[model samples]
Target: MAECNDLFLKFNDEIKLGSEKKKSLRKSRNAVGKDIQKYFDETLKVTKPKFWGQGSYMMNTIINPIEGEYDLDSGVYLMHLSDVEEEDWPATSTVHNWIKNAVKNRTSTPPQDKNTCIRVIYKDDYHVDLPIYIKNKDMEHPKLAHKSKGWIDSDPKELTKWFTDEVKEKSDQLKRIVRYFKAWKDFKANGDKFPSGMIFTILTANHYVEGYEENDDSAFVAVAKEIYDTLDENFSLDRPVFPKEELLEGWSETAKNNFLSKLSTLITNGQKALEEENKEEASKIWIKVFGDRLPKYTPPKEENRMDKGYALQTTEPPVLGNYGRSS
Candidate 1:
């Protein structure tokens, strides 16, 4: 069997958000936060909002997209004023409009007022999602301002904590496994109609296999097979925290079937790559699953191979450095 650990590590490096992009994303996030803060302080003159970094960005499982723009999710929290009663919090649409109006002109494109959050687009091909919420002392959890669904109990902080805690308990490889699955989704689905990053994160965390920390190829195959078998048996996933609601309950039949079919293909190709002996051939199989961003396999020099007895020795496991936030 071919040891493709080096190739997997290289793929991870290529797909992850680099330092420059992270810096740019941070600057964008900070600017948006300030823009929102200014609106509330100078215009709304209501309760000031608190900002919390959430989603894949905070959990550090986000990958650089293959085709579309990047995303950053920030939670905007509005504390209930002392004079206001718990039952008298602003309407969901009102709060969403407040956010929308706040960042209206921050970008050349007007802020998009969506059902769940307000989206601010930038010229750099990335956007920030500000999910508004109301926090009252009497309420157990913050309520999200959904345009259609109205105010609903939701807390992104809980979800972030859940993922970070799982990473702490499990191996850090779980994070990479999630990113690999996300990259597959981005490359194959090619749009937002597929399973979300949160869904992928939940599935990978639940099905991640231990003891393959040194071999990401084996680790990914094991996790993919586990998820495939489980979803095949019962097509459902629940949020690990908060509402604890079904994550895939809203997926259309076509979307679910398409995901399953693609996942099945990934498993077959992944197993084939593992069985292939030629390093370059194995990498080609991987390219079919991921895109051409994966590094091409290079042949060892004849002199170095002879001096190092490479023909008789086994392939070395790739040394993977820490790729994301340690937490």
Candidate 2:
């Protein structure tokens, strides 16, 4: 089998968000958050809210988009109003409108009133999603101001904590694996409809294979196969914390089928790449999975491989220890 761990690592570096881009994203998030807080203090006359990062950005698995703008999910927690009664809580739409008004005129394009959050777009090819939440002092978890569903029980902080702990207890390679999966989703979707980053994170972490810490190629193949098989059988991913709601409940059948088809192709190509002995050929197979952004394979010097007339021996596949969850 080809030794393509170095290539995989290099590809990860290329796809992940750079330090400068991350800094810019952070600046935008902080600015929007401050603007929101100022609006509450001067206009709304309510208690100031708190801000914290969430989603892939906070989890350290965020990737630079293949086409569209980068995303940063910063949550606005209305903790100061914890003394309010649940019956007296503001309506979800009213809360969303408050957030929408808070960030108006901050940018050339106005903030968007999305279904679940208010989005503030920046000119530098990035946007920040501010999801509003209310945590009453009597409640155990915060509730999101969903447009259609009203205030629903949801706690993103708990989800982030779960992913962080999983990484610490398992392998850091799991982060890379999630990024690779997201990069593939971005390339294949090409600005079209696709699964959310949260879904990919959940599935990758749940089905992660911990044994291939050193070999990303085999690890990706194994995890892809597991996800494909498991989704094919059950086709459901529930939130790991708080609400424990089914994440895919809102997905249409067409969307689920589309994701599954793409995943099948990835698994097939990845397996072929692992089986191919020629490093250059295997890298080409990977290019089919990811895009050309992945580094090309360069053949070793002739002197390094051929000794007189003897052919080089191929390396065996790494032994996989156990799955993150039972198969």
Candidate 3:
């Protein structure tokens, strides 16, 4: 237990201590993987089947880079194992023991999970929570279920290979479209709330837009524009909050105050934007705070014609029929 605690502390220091550097310490995965591999080989006296490979390089995709550091993912996998058929042997528990005892002998601090039957976690400076599970051998393999992310079992190497092959076989036109959307994410994070909302909406609607193929950058961008207009027409605000500031530098007093102020404005504006379906106005407010870089919008000719850009002015003569009207 003490060894485990020590290892956890070391990991926490490396990965979780500072926010700026806290961006997922996937680099540590190399060391961790080697250690796990060595342990597995030594204890089981059986090499991991060559066909299986490790898991994803990234855990979650980042919408805004400057806003925060990202978490990465990396893990081991076993192939040729049938998930459903393996049910005869409490497969989850069996694998969990293999990982726990293997690591325990290698590191003074063996990765330990409260329940070895379910999973064995090696909590380090960065987050390295691995879940264990067998792959269904009978059917076409599916990607790891995000909801069931904590354990191990399905061959990640197989999945990565599949994903890569699928990407290559698909038209480059679609790849370019995906890239455009990726750029849109980067741009929106910079402070273009309008594009961000539109991009998200378009990504979601792409699943349903029949005949509107997303195979090319031009096609994708066109979809983005359509979604933008649709959202603009039906836009409404709901309060939004910025993610917590968990950078490596540690939170500063000024930073905290700034976060609060920014959050308040976003919430107020978001609510107004939602009620009025004023997506443009809501986006303006959204970028004003969360955006890393301020976005520039070209005012319409009528608005730009005025020196102040465009301010609402009272043009009608003052009404006098109402009693108590100011002189």
Whole-model lDDT per candidate: 0.84, 0.85, 0.37
Give the poorly placed runs of model 2, Cα more than 4 Å off. 190-193, 250-254, 300-327
Q: Write the per-residue lDDT of candidate 2 for residues 4-45, one digit (tens) a residue.
A: 788999999999889998888888888888899999999988
Pick by lDDT: which candidate is best? Answer: 2
Global fold similarity of model 3 (TM-score): 0.38
Root-mean-square deviation (CA) per prediction = 5.1, 4.8, 17.8
Worst 10 residues of 2 by lDDT: 318-327
**Model 1 stretches with alpha carbons more than 4 Å out:** 80-83, 191-193, 304-327
Model 1 Cα lDDT, one tens digit per residue, 1-327: 677787889889888888899999989989998888888888977667888999999998899987678999999988535345657776888888888998998899999999999999998889999998877666677778899989887989998899999999997888889999998887888653767899999999999877677889888988899999999888999999997788889877777788888899998898888777777888899988988887778776434234455555545445343221111
- Which candidate ranks first by TM-score, i.e. highest? 1
Which candidate would rank higher by TM-score, 1 or 3?
Answer: 1
Put down candidate 3 lDDT per residue, 1-327, tens digits, no spaces: 000112212322322224444343544445455666676577666555222223223311122334333333444354334554533534444666665554454334555454312122334433344544345566443223223233322334443454345345543333333333443354433442323322232233332222323212124424444444443354332211122121123335554345334334433443343233332443354344334233322223332234466755444222222111111
Question: Candidate 1 overall Cα lDDT vs. reference?
Answer: 0.84
Candidates ranked, most accurate by lDDT first: 2, 1, 3
